[model samples]
Target: MANIEFFDRTMLEAMSLLAESRRYLTDKAEAESQKMDLEQGLANSMETMRLVARLTQVLAWLLTHRAVHAGEMSIAEATVPDRRLGGRDLCAKDSSDAAKTLPDELQSLLSRSHSLYLRIARLDDQATARAEINTKVSGGPRPQ
Candidate 1:
């Protein structure tokens, strides 16, 4: 009867240890999952920032061109409207001509903006790949 009791206590202790180990593994897996999610979020945020920077650069170039063109048009003599059209048409023509003759500096800025956009796109793709990898790592079957 004493041997039977001893065996029962040993079985209970073994089960308790197994339960504790399982809980520890579960907690560890949860922590790792949280870490992966955080990393993915950070990568997404970084990609968004890169996109914002590219857009800002493009907008700045456009604004600068508009400002410079407006200044030049302000000093020029306005043309009279033809008999077939209104006075606004003459100003529109002048503005169109001015746009066609953008300064070299403005062209350079546009080129740089295009390059920046391409770089941002590449970085976004890289971030997406990294996030996918992290997701797979956290969710996939454990290694032996």
Candidate 2:
């Protein structure tokens, strides 16, 4: 299905970006972190956490959708609050001023992860809306 293809593409992109971010964070960023002043170092650490959180949320949502597509999870199950896209308060928060001074690679990772999370959040909202509409139309789930 067209929607499946979209998710597949998105999943691949997220995976690629996540891997790149990990490499940069574990290698270059870790080394550069020691060179920063206390304030900047704290900012870098916080931003790094934000970046990881964004990607983790994105990946989790994508995997849930993937499970639904694979028939491993019902649409209703995936729409549940616990399974839905989360971390909006933190993941969607704007980067701090001090974060702007972080390494170029880290800044780029934060930007990319934020953008990806926003896109996936939109998808989650759309999917949940559609599920609600279907439930309304069918007058709730039938016996299974």
Candidate 3:
């Protein structure tokens, strides 16, 4: 019950952060207006993409667990590969050096999103491990 509440709080917070970041990006000045060089512009784009991807992954994973809790999805189903947390390769990568020049809000969003993604990824791993152990104990088919 506590885990569910914790994830619920985290999900709401992540959603709010995602919305705020979106608004900031939408209202932000164009790269040229900010006098960003080509490299800086590219870095900004990449970091922005990473930020969105990270949050999207977090939301999807949270929603999956939410469904399980709601009885709309089984725990076994949620642990499946397709339903598991994703975008690790992209979301886990370090922000580019040029991304350091981005606006402070953007930097903070990036940091927070990355941290949240990592936290959820750890949970995902733990879930997978538990599912694997359950399969072994039950002599059931292994998780794909």
Q: TM-scores of all models? A: 0.29, 0.92, 0.90
- Misplaced by over 4 Å in model 3 are 29-34, 96-98, 142-144
Tens digits of per-residue lDDT for model 2, 4-91: 8888889999999999997998779878999999999989889988998999999999999999899998777788888889999999
Which candidate, 1 or 3, has the higher lDDT? 3
Which pairs of residues have clashing backbones in candidate 2? none
* Candidate 1 per-residue C-alpha lDDT over 47-87 given as tens digits, one digit per residue, 9 for 90 to 100: 32332344443333333323434554210111111111122
- Candidate 3's residue-wise lDDT over 1-144, tens digit each? 898789889988999988988888788836433677777777888888899899889999998998988999767778999989999999987784556788888888888888888889999999888878887888988646
lDDT for each candidate structure = 0.36, 0.87, 0.84
Model 2: residues with Cα > 4 Å off, grouped in runs: 96-98, 141-144
The Cα error of candidate 3 at residue 5, in Å, is 1.2
lDDT of 2: 0.87
Q: Cα lDDT for residue 2, model 2?
A: 98
Candidate 1: misplaced stretches above 4 Å? 1-53, 57-100, 140-144
